[model samples]
Target: MAAYSVADGAEVARQVATLPDGGSSDSLCAGAWLSAAGERQAFNDDFTLLAGTVPGPGNKGKTATAFSVSGGSPVSTGPGATASDDRAPVFQSGTSTLWYVTGDRHLTSRDLKQPSAAPADHGTAPGQSFLLAGDRPWVRAPLEVTPDQAAVAPGGTVAVGSNLLWRRTDPAASFAEQNVEPAVLGPSLNGRAPVPGSEAMPACAARLWFDDLSLLCNARNTLLRVTFAPDHSRVDKVETLIPEEQGLIPGAVLSPDGRSLAFLREWAGTVDLYRLDLSAGAAPVRIASLAAGAPTGSGGVGRDVRVIAWQ
Candidate 1:
């Protein structure tokens, strides 16, 4: 059954839909963005939906068909539409600029308002790459240290990876080679370590930046709230939001107000959606049962169930 709901967890009317390629929905990769007028617009990677041929592996092809969330026929963004190397397009907040990485790995931006206009190519420096921290674009230097995860602060500070946090004060600046002291995890509630003793704790990858100094992260199967020192030199504190005992949390999206987090948990061949209030000691409540045997994408986030937007 297809489930559609509002932000309040109230079930809304549902309409049946199919992929443009006539393929199972499992192969679809979808995302959402807010328009200038605050309407939620959704896009997906079903090339045929726009009458375009799907690109083969590592080939550049037109993707990203835009549609209304309230219900409407999907529209093609045009023949030139493409996404980043990851097959996902990053929409800039408060603007129609769609930022993505081209097949050559160069950072590119296209204006959705004028879909046919040529995209602006922001050439990456030799041995460098670009990424989106929230809605802001940033360049990672020396590309050798490929970050497993990253997050950007409002003032331009960026934290990459967990354990030994790689940090930089500005987008154009090189990362500080010195290892910042690792975040100290709170004691395990069940007296169990994430891993066996002395094997190194699981890396807590940043999922979303809560503010300029703090972010929400996922370490193994747990959620952590990490706050950095003012100088960005070391972790000031770490609080366990969701313990690892709850099972694997593959993906999560924070509410716009930062008061709640919606995440996907998988176990026993079943996937479920749960929402946790950020309030003190709040627990996650199962909101919906997604699908059985759902396929997970590159980062282990389920492709069958995606949280497009949280109003």
Candidate 2:
């Protein structure tokens, strides 16, 4: 894999590592993120750096690893370091604490400072979740009492579900279900409806904007910006950044400044990366083509590329 600068799209660094299932020949079951200081933390089903001799056993599952952008030897947290699940391991951001779901479906956390120690069990894992940043940091998992997927704003207000926006300011508070009015499409696309028989998409892959007043989500094969009322009582607006006609967006990440979004889209057997400025009426600009081969996995819709992080 290679690291490129978002500013000029210049390749800055490249690391050759051997991934499980015959390197890149199989589905890339891996994820990575960069720290503010430019260090990369990543995980793979089984991985080995170019300098390493043996790859981790696939049966042991995903292994957590670390690398430096400046170039150096990579480090692995070792076998049994993480759960065998496909979900990417999430860091607390700016801390040594990491969070992941166990094979038994338990949400667990452990500190890198104590790598060999047992992880602290949090509870049953949610259907979907992400880190909620604040003075009191916590994992924004699905509500135990409800089936809806949830995303927590920086101020502690939670937005639940997709067909409708449900608001609950506190964990102990009751949710106020609110309807999300149809998106205000452009004149040429007015009155258009979702493809027939498509299931309602959830906001599980949403990123809380830096401002915290809105969420940038890739759902329904489109990019949307869901804005909330200042009081956090209801959703004030829902805007489509990129329409579904574009293609299947496997993943997206917000820029550090929250002014742009980078995502991976697969269309016509080709996967390409695109960046969009959040400005009004701005169009997406193609950055790179990730892959051009016969689609893999079921239904021939599996994505070969994924956006891990924007920073």
Q: If scored against the real structure, what TM-score would every candidate get?
A: 0.62, 0.57
> Residue 9 error for model 1, in Å?
4.3
Query: For model 1, how does the per-residue alpha-carbon lDDT over 1-311 read when each residue is reduced to its tens digit?
Result: 23445344455544444434422211123221111111111232211121112343355443433333334344445455454332234445545565555556666666656767876766652222334544445454222223223444666654543333444544454322233223233333233222112123355555666777776776657777777677665566777887677556645777778888877677655677788899998998888766643455555645345443454
Q: Which candidate is the best by TM-score?
A: 1
Relative to the true structure, candidate 1 reaches a TM of: 0.62
Give the lowest summed-lDDT range of ten residues in model 2.
31-40
Cα lDDT listed for each candidate: 0.49, 0.47
- For model 2, the local distance difference test gives 0.47
**Superposed model 2: Cα runs more than 4 Å off:** 7-10, 16-89, 100-108, 113-150, 159-207, 292-296, 299-304
lDDT of 2 by residue, 1-311 (tens): 55557766566765554334422211133221111111112322122222111123554544333332234344455435543442334445445555555556666665655768766766665433333232222334332312212344555554433232333434442212222332211121234333122223343344344456776655647876766567544456767788667577766777878788887777666777789898888898888665543245444554434465675
